[model samples]
Target: MPAVSDLTSHIGYLLRMVSNAVSQEFARKVADEGVTVAEWAMLRSLYGGDGIAPSALAGKMGMTKGAISKLAERLLDKGLIERTGNPGDMRGHSLSLSPMGAKKVPVLAGLADENDATFFSVLSGEEQDRLRGLLHMLIDKSGLSTMPVD
Candidate 1:
């Protein structure tokens, strides 16, 4: 076997560590706002769209439908989202941010911007763009459409 120093380190390991740290920090920052990271993501997705099917949202978020349903239920309980019967498909339902939720998305979006800047402000604009491109490439190559946490 090759020596550790000579062996290539797996990008997945590093990505997981960094992502977890960022996620944890973001969660802490937003906890007082009464939204979990996952919930925030769902809200963000619906911020502008008229409404989306739960199944479609699941696919868009790269999560299982069960997970999406659970999150949707929580948001409903919080009055952060409203669910309605889909006219196009009676068997399915659609979701949109509630009036309060609609109002809060922009505030939450600002928080998200701050969180990103807190972590990435060290990089120059060019470097930040390059890093984003590289990360997208890695995700594309790895066939990863959703965020990953370890």
Candidate 2:
């Protein structure tokens, strides 16, 4: 009789195992920068853009409006972001990074680079490129555009 397929043999299991490891390590590294992984995602998404409403950011980040408001408030408390009335809509407000956040983004981005390098250094350059291509292909195929924060 054939043996039953094991969880370890599944691609999703393997991918998730690696993902959890990479994410946990990255989270630890970024914690020293005074940012959680979710915060990093939100901050990075807001980095290059103008002020955006919480509802708009919610759509962009694949999160809820309430969650965006909570994050905005936390970042505001940290002095990392500022919120102002939306010029286009009186009912909504727009959010953007503060000068301090703008300065910290590059530093946090460098940490991300270093984390990737450290974790994937075992792979050859060709292997790295191939892995990236495969992942991007999978992402495209799955229509997954959300920035993984959780």
Candidate 3:
């Protein structure tokens, strides 16, 4: 008979457990501000830019074009983002944050900082830096550029 592996002994399982806790906590906090993590990612991506192509934003976020379009529509409905015809490509539109979105970005970012601090308060600054570095190293080694969103 083959031996049965214990899931609790796996590093990936431990990582997922912690990741879920952190992400869920952040999700709740951001929901209080009327957005999902995905929406937050979209807003953050558009914060400082002049306009970017939908395809570009999608690529940067590691999301599909359809997902980007849906997020864009929601932002447009909220008047947080505006779409303008692409100068170089008439068939395409560039998306940019509206003034309202520009104002909200900082507030949302502050919430994000608070959420992270709340969850990671147990860790010292050095520990936090180390954890981040390790995670970045893993991401680089694995070639994992996908944005975490739900």
Candidate 4:
């Protein structure tokens, strides 16, 4: 193998490291809010849209139905979300944020914005846009439609 240089470490590895760090921080910040990162993701998905079937929500979040079910149960227990029988599909249910859940979504979104600013504000506006473009390109090139939290 050729001698490794600083650049030889590859963008993928660097992106993964940065991603993991940011995710960890977000998880820690949200833990006390009575939701995991996964749950928050689901809540965010349901924030503005009309009710969505659990399976559809799972697909949107790139998670398994089982995982979505578990998170939904937790959200239900916390009174942050509710499940209603789907009128079109008797065997299926749709999820939406309860009034409380709807209320919390914006708060959580604000926190997310704050977190991003805190961590990424060092980058200039152009740099941030460039980074987002590059990351999107990498995702497209890598065929990564979903990211696993685990």
Every model's TM-score: 0.87, 0.92, 0.93, 0.88
Q: Candidate 1 residues 1-150, lDDT tens each?
A: 775742227776777777777778888766778988888899998988889999899889999999999999999999999999977877988999999999988888888789889888999999999999998997889899884411
Q: Cα deviation of 147 in candidate 4 (Å)?
A: 4.6
**For residues 1-150, could you state the per-residue lDDT of candidate 2 as single tens digits?**
988999999999999999998999999988999988899889998998888888889999988888888888889999999999966778878899999999989999999999899889999999999999999999999999777887
Which ranking of candidates, highest lDDT first? 3, 2, 1, 4
Q: Which runs of model 4 end up more than 4 angstroms from their true locations?
A: 1-8, 147-150
Candidate 2 at 44: error in angstroms? 0.4
**Model 3 Cα shift for residue 117 (angstroms):** 0.8
Poorest 10 consecutive residues by lDDT, candidate 3: 28-37
Instruction: Tell me the deviation in Å of residue 61 in model 3.
Output: 0.9
- The TM-score measured for candidate 1 stands at 0.87
Rank order (by TM-score, best first): 3, 2, 4, 1
Q: How many clashes (backbone N, Cα, C below 3 Å) per candidate?
A: 0, 0, 0, 0
Q: For residues 21-99, what per-residue lDDT tens digits would candidate 4 score against the true structure? A: 7888878878868788877888888988889998888788888899888989999999999889977878988899999
**What Cα-based lDDT does every candidate model obtain?**
0.86, 0.91, 0.91, 0.84
Candidate with better lDDT, 3 vs 4: 3
Error of 2 at 43 (Å): 0.6
* Stretches > 4 Å off in candidate 2: none
